[model samples]
Target: MGFPKHLTSAIIRLELPKNDGGLILTKNLYLSCDPYMRSRMSRSTEGSYVDSFTPGSPISGNGVSRVLDSSLPGFKKGDLIWGVINWEEYSLIKDTSSLIKIQHIDVPLSYYTGILGMPGVTAYVGFYEICSPKKGDTVFVSAASGAVGQLVGQFAKLYGCYVVGSAGSKEKVDLLKNKFGFDEAFNYKEEQDLNAALKRYFPNGIDIYFENVGGKMLDEVLRNMRHHGRIAACGMITQYNLDQPEGIQNLFLIVAKRIRMEGFLVFDYCHLYPKFLEMILPLIHEGKITYVEDIVEGLENAPAALIGLYSGKNVGKQVVAIAHE
Candidate 1:
């Protein structure tokens, strides 16, 4: 069995509770199916940031929902919010601290599940805060066609940096170079020698490396970093499934290059969401920024959609659309 084996059945249904005491019942509109969710599928969530998904229990992740019934003071019925929500149609959220009420409806409601929500904030904090790029910096992004990487490449370009991205397939490489406007990009799977491939694109060495697929790619990247280069260690999908995580042979470069490598969680930067949205929404409105979502129509397909992430099946941001506005 892959990460999630249980068939998410269509028969499993739940409606909003008529009354809630110190809780809010909501109708889940969109569910985010991401690689990170696999960490929760394990029997134990030890060493994992989020709690594990208990078997036979409702699985929850970042979602956009409509408040149906509320016994809380700040929340009211019919209000729109996005936060940790269950895989089912309706859910009762007791700890309301993580939730955010949707303020801007001009954009698509489903955006709250991807670019406008956690993944957006993730890219924002990782690039601007962690990477600390300067104008004319040479940047590289691995797995660049996904929800987060595409935005990072665009952000680097907006900062007047030369960006190169890598993906597993030709279609994604084309998306990076042609659609996302990356100066250069390549299909990593096609390259026989990753180090030489990186050298071809980044002749002067990478000033900022957005670390997505970690393992072999990271090993090659460490060899090509400029002095004082920064690496924002995002999700390392390559090491996630391995029985023993691959060791990087060239970590000595960190000391030699004075590189700063950091890992971040979107929650720590939640306070900056408003600022992030302000910068992105205008770009979106002016048609300067664009996002793509591969949405599965119903909840039942969530299992397959989530597992497909590891296989690189979904094209863009993988969103499980539950209910419409």
Candidate 2:
């Protein structure tokens, strides 16, 4: 009945495979568990940018790794990198296209899997590119304590926007307000009427919405959006596992309010990685921006950590530590 049921681990001999060319061997330090990976678990990923996982093969995701051996010219031995890697202690990456060398190591190596890696870029592109935010804008973020959501809220606050976020628990709500510096935050689970909750937060109307949780929450957000408002559709974690996803009732409001709802993929905006790092790295060092991670140690426990995202078990970004470098 749960995602954990579908996952099983097996042990193989600690041996290296013959590298013909363009392959790099790595010792995976940390693995990321993202909500989007749930879609990749399906047998068919018709139009998805990412391929479906092979039934009996290792599930791959973004991770921080130390290169042990390399047949590629760009990567050398002991070069730290972050990119698509397998869910194991060691991985032989056949595709070197996705990998990026990590130049900055002052921060935790595990941070390459969250704050300094994919989620960080996602927040950057989704907010800055997709949602054209301005100062004094009323911004709302759903699932705001998660990897991308937390960063989006903080970015909005730093940009002089009035930010509010909704999470599943009081602990995460408090983290959003007190830690991430959101103007206000509330627990969506405790709200009887989501539309009323949005009304309470934004009496005028929402100018920008960083959507992570879709379904009822999105429908409510549509009704409370201001004219010419923008919405960055980041992820719909609520609909990932459903056979029939819920439909939004207020989509008609998109036309009525002149709402700009756009969906984005991190890969599309990868050319801006340097720009993102330039902005985020300084904030991180100056302590102007903060990140929270719910890391579970050991590769064997990775399945449980990934499954925890759906039930709101993780308080922040969920990461699996395979081996520290």
Candidate 3:
């Protein structure tokens, strides 16, 4: 494949395999955007857990695809699946382990890129396993309008908890409260003081805080956590773009309040994927759970969609609809 002149530029081209054991896939759909992809764009000293996208090479991301040709067994033609792949119409999957077979198609195929895939599992493990939420507890989620945050808020509400969410815009705040059924929703951008904002909503202090956007928001949350409060550290979106991350001055509060803070990666809990599906699928069928998606049309709009995540431009789960499955 020929390289584009710019770092952000992505162009499609045909190329022969440089090695064997590679599988070719026809890209059925592409996920529009995610904040993490921004990190991969830069040339950094810190190595990526997932390999960085190379210049002139086809950019890859989590997408739902169909197997076209395979050297590997089980994954034959017509197999529907989702995983990391190129931005082009066709992709050569060098690592077959990254691909997973899609067994159920009764639900929307786009779901495999978001809700039924990485973000869904992230919410499940972070809220259930890491936070250890209990019934009737108070739960707060930062970036509540986002992909993972939206699901977290809903799951907490379903567990019979008082859920409050903070989002950047008025529309997002309204969606959190009205559509997602959060007990209360506030526009953090309007509030001058996040600590005071939290106190106004959660007078008793927060029992569980789902930490999505870090920096000052996290610092304020630390001061407001009740005794033995659990803080599930997901992604720190606030600090992701900054050259120097903000310092949390209220570290002593964790010790004083006996708060428990744990950081987690969803892949660490992949074993629980089946169990998560078992728990969440029934909730979906009963209409106890609702998912929101902000979908962009075509692969060409993918770059803008991904970049929108950082600016809080997306209302819900950001996905790119490449083709109808």
Candidate 4:
């Protein structure tokens, strides 16, 4: 166990460890910087599903890596895999539970950290399953240009839904409407009243809300939901770093409008990964779906890359490039 403290970038040199038969040694290729990781930085993760990071130790998150040597069964040298791996250059993995061997390389390998991996699965399960989206429904997404939110907007658009999204900047707002094919997008920071902004984009009222950000935004979305609308609570990036989470004043609207808001964790739905890939891989190949990544080179810059996510410094999926395969 390690004490919790504010995040700071540091590098420590260590000699290569002798890999025992049970361990799989890997050279990390890419690491994902996601908003959910902030919760792990806290000293006590009381309500968080994931465990807190041990301070002064190598923190781990979703990463793409290639196996160099493996003595573990079901894994061998030269296998490309993605899952939870250490932030360091070389990791001797003892836990194989989260590891998934990559079967497709036709797409960019760095995508495993974003659209093709956890974020992909997250967007799939949240929109299709939790939201029960119907064609022609009006949809709104928060943090719209991010890893998971981008995919959710595209998915809703493909499903024939009228899609709108909210991002933090003009650049991201442009990307959502121009690049991601969103019906409309707004820079939330520029909006004095989010409720009015949402109403302007969704005059018919939102039928589905892909919630990546919470706090004041959620309070407004609740007020804008139509009867029997669905809300998929994928993440609440705004509240992760706060000493106390904000309250939603319009939660009563959920009952008044007969809305259904469900929170989900992607890990619990991993069984659907095969189904998700079957649907998404074709979309990627046909250019029906597009993914953007903000790649930061080297392990030393990983901390800043992760920190950038909270401040909306990243334009898309933030990835730290550690090594080339």
Best by the TM-score measure: 2
Compose the digit string of candidate 2's lDDT tens values, residues 12-105.
4344456565777788899999998887877665646788877667788999999887877898889999989888787777788888999999
Model 2: ten consecutive residues of lowest lDDT: 1-10
Tell me the lDDT of candidate 1. Answer: 0.87
What TM-scores do the predictions have? Answer: 0.94, 0.95, 0.91, 0.94
- Poorly placed runs, candidate 2 (over 4 Å): 1-19
Total clashes, candidate 4?
0
Off-target runs (Cα >4 Å) in candidate 1 are: 7-19, 43-46
**Model 4 residue 179 CA deviation in Å:** 0.8
Candidate 1 residue lDDT tens string, 34-97: 7787777665556688888877777788999998878888999999999888888877788988
Q: What lDDT score goes with residue 42 in model 3?
A: 67
Q: Looking at candidate 2, what is the lDDT of residue 31?
A: 94
What value does the lDDT take at residue 74 in candidate 3?
A: 73
Give the higher-TM-score candidate: 1 or 3. 1
| Model 4 misplaced stretches (Cα beyond 4 Å) | 1-19
TM-score-superior candidate, 1 or 2: 2
lDDT of 3: 0.82
